[model samples]
Target: MKSYLGLIPISAKVHRRQNRMTILCIVFAVFLVTAVFSMAELGVRIEADRLLEKHGSQELENLAGSTMAQTLYPIAAVLTLLILIAGVLMISGSINSTVAQRTKFFGMMRCIGMSRQQIIRFVRLEALNWCKTAVPAGVALGIMAAWLLCAVLRFLVGGQFSEIPVFGISITGIVIGSVTGIAAVLLAARAPAKRAARVSPVEAVSGNEKGTGALRHGAKLCLFRVETALGIHHAVSAKKNLILMTGSFALSIMMFLSFSVLVDFVGYLMPQYSDASDIDISGSGGADTVDSGLLDTLSGMEGVKRVYGRRTSFQVPVEISGAAEGFGAAESSGAADLISYDDFGLDCLKKDDMLKKGSDISKVYGDSGYVLATSDADSLLRIGDKVKIGAEELEIAGLLKYDPFSSDGLTHGEVTLIMSGETFIRLTGITGYSLISVQTTGNVTEEDVEAIRAAAGEDCVFSDRRDQNTSGTYRAFAACVYGFLFVITLVTVLNIVNGISMSVSARTKQYGTMRAVGMDGRQITKMIAAEAFTYALSGCAAGCAAGLFISKWLFDVLIAAHFAYAVWELPVNSLLVILLAVILAAVLAVWAPAGRIRKLSVTETIGEL
Candidate 1:
């Protein structure tokens, strides 16, 4: 060899089996960054097209630079950072275990006059060498995943995503993934490399260089069996390894909990109502000219599931009773938007659980002199307050959790009073509806829409929004969040399994000695299981404690701050699911290692490593 540096590739080649976990970590990190950024690019493209089509070029330009439009990049960046951290933890643990096993090899190099800097370079270069194959494989897998996601959005979703290219390549994604993979591998190799250089030649050559702290006391045998207690001791004996393993498991849970908040944020951002219409019919010039009888006509149609209409009068004068006067009533000249809902509309509201606590939907369902109001943070309106319109005084029997009309859940300076259609007609002396909405059956066709259009005549405006429902945004968001969660879970499980297997391999000689001392295979297996469980239990406790606070913080920032109606609650179901996953991972992690230990030839294992 020309120089000691030439041994780097040879070392990696000889230790290929042990290096697989490190390579996998790099691949996973690269894949995540590539897939996420690629999907973000596609999503931005799809959203831009939809906006450009809905509004003209001038309006599109205005919205293109808006804060909402620029949110995707920051979100993608955060996800990339999380994936990077996970990669570092997994890869570092793997390399540390490898170094502990190869103490003699590094010690020999040091004895042959290898400088510490050269040893560090050799270890780092060995790690980088694996990236030659890992990076390309990861990028390829990432591109395929992005293509698959695009296909799902375009074919299955089929709304605003119809124009997205299924097989498109994103240069930005490719570059970012490659760079992140290299960076993660380099960062992960640093501490292990330095530790390897610090290995003492005399201890390593004498075969006493097993990297573990001397125990200050014996295992607590009273609480557990001999085998289990020994296994727990083995786990806790290596303080660094214990920390790495626990951190890997805990980070996975934390990331899962944090990402879950995004699902709720998306729900609020594109709030979908249970009564959302597939088709809408409204009067021209914002007038209540559409016949209210058309609601019944559409409801009876063959392809219609249900129908509802609203009679609305904007900025109607009103008189507020005591305690209701703080709703900016005096400044706005006692004006509020007056709206009336039919039985079906009120039923939809009840089904959607939009009514706040203590709401009484029954009184507002009929011609009773009780009405519902939409509230915001600053409003002083409450249930049981009186709102007088003209000569009639209507009691506020309920309040909506938010102003459904406003995107941010705020009323934006105007109070809204909602009542039954009969009460509205009695108060305003108007019988026509300003807007009518139709819910369609599963097999609804254009013929049904045309029939309804013919019934309403050309005087009323018609809109078909079946393919443009906002629920698609929710589905897309859910798919993305769950996809990320699945990847994180896979990485966590693999890290746990790999770490346990390495632990088993490093302690093979010890196991063989125990076997020679008459410890049976079952005892050995129990010992391994105990070790795995120790790691799992510690990780679970730490993960859940940190995850709960992070989940709440994310919820407060992403959902609660902007939307007055949103509140954080304990995610019991999420906690249960995460705990179940961690338990399953621990079981799986123990399986292969225990089996290998059970099948080991005691004499050969003792003589080999």
Candidate 2:
């Protein structure tokens, strides 16, 4: 008797076509894992080296000892876990299908006095034979992918990471990728291998495979044409297989939608600037740098919609009675920043959608009313409460959430009090505006921005919100998301193609019988197309539903808890993209396999059995 190890090469060579998809699955998983890890490790190392050079080795060591291990390790671990899960699912699906197709072959081996252990070994070794080629190819692909990703990040985004080193092929990444890839393959093969070992010779010869079941009992009952009914019957024949195919397809769609939603939601919740303005012109120097003359000049500019300015005060003494720390020019109150806006400034805030909650500043323009900008939990004073800043006493009018020009700095930190122009003038007796805010009309052109900048002068700073650094960050993140989307999409397409091909290949005899009787190639292609459509419809519907829940959960956990209003918008574009892709995949999957079977003669097809 041939040793199981020796039989593996023969088995793998003979059934190479059947194992092709499984091999590709392993290859893709390993490639992604290695490339991602390599990129991540390289980034960390580069950052660490830069920090060490700038801050000295001791401080760098401390950062590495504390932050690097604490944060980076946890993220790496979680990423590794997710990749492993994906790998296992892909490999297991292929292995399960492979074993189902080879039931008769397994049973014949059993009849030749092969032990259960020998069968298991044979299956595992056959998978390993594919890995020998796949692992090296996967590693090489990973290196190339990492290099490409780095180049894109550096040249395309052009921001903070523009100078950072983006690529390094880490030995650690290679080892982890290779090890996890093989581990996932082995674990996935175990169940199918064991099942193959248990198949009886009698059952195999009788054509009673593990996944097969009773044929369509009542063909006329199906609510479709004969060809369509047969296609549907073929899909539902093995309920487990249907579920597996649909589930895998659904997960791919779900991941794409959920990740896209996360990117959009995060951008909304954590804005780069106060608002999405076309142009933002702030004085580079002190408030004195931007005088009333410049403000008038900017307001009258052609593309400028409105111009506003704010008088800012820092570390002013305040007294909040009944406070735990007895706030007095402290970080909680007076030491915090204060912004007083005129009526025009108030209008600008409203136009930019920066107001969270409060009546118009017009209501408190000349009154003693004040708006407190602090977290609800950490608020020292409530609405209607009187507080004394220096000599002027003011009542808390309302609460303002995160705003761009606040003491809390964009999202959260220290508290600031906002008051009307008159109230601000009457209280601190200051009259100069510190920050000049500008809003331009729709899609400000480069000439408009240059004109503004020229008017502001070289000494005074100018910013076009359209060209903010946050845009670079957003693009980088979006690219990363789309990269993941691409990977999952490729995997999904492969799964569909492999699944359809395997199903059609297994039914060669049935197709031959139909062709011999009367059915044409067009009818055969239509039947396969119908089957693919059913699977795509079922999978996409289920996936969209799951994606919505995931997006909401991600918003709640990542965004809502951190900042303000985490609204869950429908991922309409993402849904449309997923639907279109699924449809295309279904068509390609069915068309390719059906075309092959259609060209074969009845005798040649039946002879395949």
Candidate 3:
């Protein structure tokens, strides 16, 4: 039972710059988790409410409960996990730097009979104290950020955000932020703690940084382990850095893992949506009530192939519980499905890759909410769920995920389904198609989409798959996420490389001593490299597992927020690619820094230390 006071010395040991970096990372992590989760959830909730509360709406309670009743836990999980990892690394980095400076102090402690356990306990306390000071503050600051966001959203949409918490004062938010922050801090502290406790009293008192001859030791040895004649020797190590080094490596791995998973997951799912065609067409209404017949007429008059329907709408209205009052209160909030008519149904046409998203609603709905959807609407809509229209609710059966790469509009993701004439009339009291898709009757070699547009007239809109731009939206978002992750990874790699470098620096005299006693620079380099390798390998494995779990959760948040959104179509190579890449990078990042170990002057280095 160590006194909390014990944390002071450890705290004193941490560098201010490193501390601030950790704090910033925590802040960003908190912001990312809270913002993404809350926005997606709150937005979908509002979309549902808007539909039902409007005149002629039905199925208010059942639809709302069923649709909005998914989990926010996954969102929380991803954010917490990521933030936790980052925090740990930052703490670990600080600890490693500190221990390098305080190496001798620890040696002195050991000489005085302070046990390794005691030193380890001291470092832990120091880490705990820092977490106590930093994490809570970050959580609080994250919470306060609501006002600013609310003001901004309100200004943009007039009244689409609530002034209050959408999920009850965000208590869960604060708790999560704090917990993750603390967890990260602790995780990063391991390496520094371990190394700081193992210093020898002799090394501590001598102050003469000299080369020592290494005798090998057995089975489980220290950081630098080798299977040699003297068994495996304990070439004196640092206690303070034990925690720091571990933490930094772990965090870096986490970053690598997170980014790789996200990319792989997204990459896996995007192609499933490919329509394989160069053009698709849609309109306001037509025969069979599925294709409006307009696209069929035009394409029949020209070149095209098989066309079909796609799920083009998944919209709902929700009274956002925790969002600000006006956060989702649209001046006129309602729902509609984007569809393509024909045996070539909207859903089928999507299979053909012929949609120019929102083109169906162009003339009638224009860019206005009355017909076209606003990017604002996308924040509130889902892709496969049902949206209420007047007295009827159109099931969003098939539609591309709402994203700007296609076009900015509510209709982008939410499609007003073109159902069986019987189903449509029975459900919506409407017996006409909202849109249609036309297939090229022949080779239909029109690569220029606009040329087909002339044939489509105002009756239909068309696009082809060659350069149809299906990957744009998905790639954009993925790029942003990966780019952000990349920056974090870069920082993490630098920290890791530096930590390893410092590790070698501190052990200069030890290396010199070893060389004097018969150990060569190559052997010493290998030893140091082994230490860095451990960190990299451990970091990567842990990071991959963590990143996958987090990415899955984030995907779920998208699903929960959007009633009918399909599960992301993950690719086969996703997991394999990510794992391999991260592990490779970790190895590479450490390689250069560790390689320099052999470059040190054996005699001079040993003598100077």
Candidate 4:
């Protein structure tokens, strides 16, 4: 048993390519996990420090022990678990493919009286040996990555992020990465090691690891030539490999799309300055304070693109029949405040594409009766249903996902009913503008903004999206989220690389045989490409569908219900980028290996066979 240990080193050296790939997989996974954990931990620390500075150090002795730090711990835990799962699958698939290729070697060991236990031990030790070298290297890389990330964040956030660590390295992150990396390698190696131990001497010697696949009655033609068709068939014939490869590709796409949705979702739910306008002016007293004269002046101001105004009123009564189950709206009976928009105001809303349902306002100008503001409570109001307001019965023209005036006040628990200016006069019998929003042309300077502010007067309140109170904080959060997402996506790309590499390397002899039978280099490359195309197309399609479905549910649960904002739309740009990335990855995965095979002489390849 002691003597058999020598075989482990010998086997590793003999199959250095496979061993190198396995080590790379472990290294990349550990590196990413460590980097992400470190980043999250640093963020927690920085935030806690800020709190401590605000509340005093005696309030919380250690930043790590703070409430914010504790909250971050769970998020870190969940993210670590997800990364570990992906790492294990990636490492396991690489091992499985490599082991299958080395059946003959395993068989020889079995014939020489090496017990199955010895073989398993040998394989396990080899994996552990690789981890010994890879884990530390990965941890070091992770620390560097985390430091760089922190620096980038500091740069983007400027002096506002005074407490951000310049050289932060989390001890917990290193320990976690080492433990998870070692554990993942062991778990991933078990199946492949067992399979190797079970290989029979005869089967190994004869090089007959698998039986012939189910035969086709007739030759099936494909869009490509015979070589390409044969390659596609060969690729899909191995059900396990096909599924693994496709799944790897699909998960990469799915994660990218879903994370993109999450970013957009969070942005939408959070209170931010409107994208449609550079400056917003509101009446100091009430809805009637900002009049037509002020709006006209703002519209004609230098650098101003356009100006729009809305007449807003609070506590207008609208008849409600069946109140929603849990909205706590029974007290008000769904009698929301009324916000009336003029034609220009409606045009602004249309430009922003803020409507959640119903046709564009222009299409339903004269035909539509009223568009209701989105309600926090699940009110029993449907589009086209005639509901009685103060004095008139009007049809619910549409449902709005956004109303700027309502959102700012509604957080304190108020429901608003949005309508056109004509409807507001008919129902409330009052007509005066409350808020006047300003949109600037091209790039508006600080001087321009000041001029506009002066023109609006000191009494009027001006709000700029660029200078919003939470803009800096939001930028930091967005930067962290996007950086974390990029790391996860990179890990997935590594998985694809490993899966493709193993598949191609395992078929070395088969390729050689084809070469010997008169298949040229170009033909061989095309064959490999066809197989990649099949996998890429199938995987990308399935992943996109799954991602969209998940995004819908996520939007409903996390954003729509929580914020009472029902505008959930697909992140089309993100999905398109993902699709393009998958295609490019597939091409590179095939092209690289094919290029290597093309380098080897036909005789050399046949000799391995």
- Give me the candidate number with maximum lDDT: 1
Candidate 1: where are CA atoms >4 Å away?
A: 1-16, 42-70, 107-118, 149-168, 200-208, 221-231, 282-293, 310-373, 381-399, 412-434, 441-443, 458-461, 511-527, 541-573, 601-609
Predicted structure 4, TM vs. truth: 0.74
Give the per-residue lDDT digits (tens) of candidate 1, residues 69-137.
Answer: 466676678767777877787888888888878888888888889888988998898888989999999
Is candidate 1 or 3 superior in TM-score? 1
**lDDT digits (tens) for residues 80-177 of candidate 4:** 66557656767777887888788788888889998999889888888888887899998998899777766765775555564477797799889998
Each candidate: what lDDT?
Answer: 0.83, 0.69, 0.50, 0.70
Residue range with the least summed lDDT across 10 consecutive positions in model 1: 324-333
**What's the best-to-worst order under lDDT?**
1, 4, 2, 3
| Candidate 3 structure quality by residue, lDDT tens digits, 432-475 | 44444444543555553456677557654444544443354455
lDDT of 2 at 187: 80
List residue ranges in candidate 2 displaced over 4 A: 1-4, 39-82, 151-163, 198-211, 214-216, 219-222, 261-402, 407-474, 553-568, 603-609
State candidate 2's TM-score.
Answer: 0.68
State which candidate, 2 or 4, has the greater lDDT: 4
Q: Can you list the residue pairs that collide in candidate 4?
A: 370-397
lDDT of 3 at 363: 23
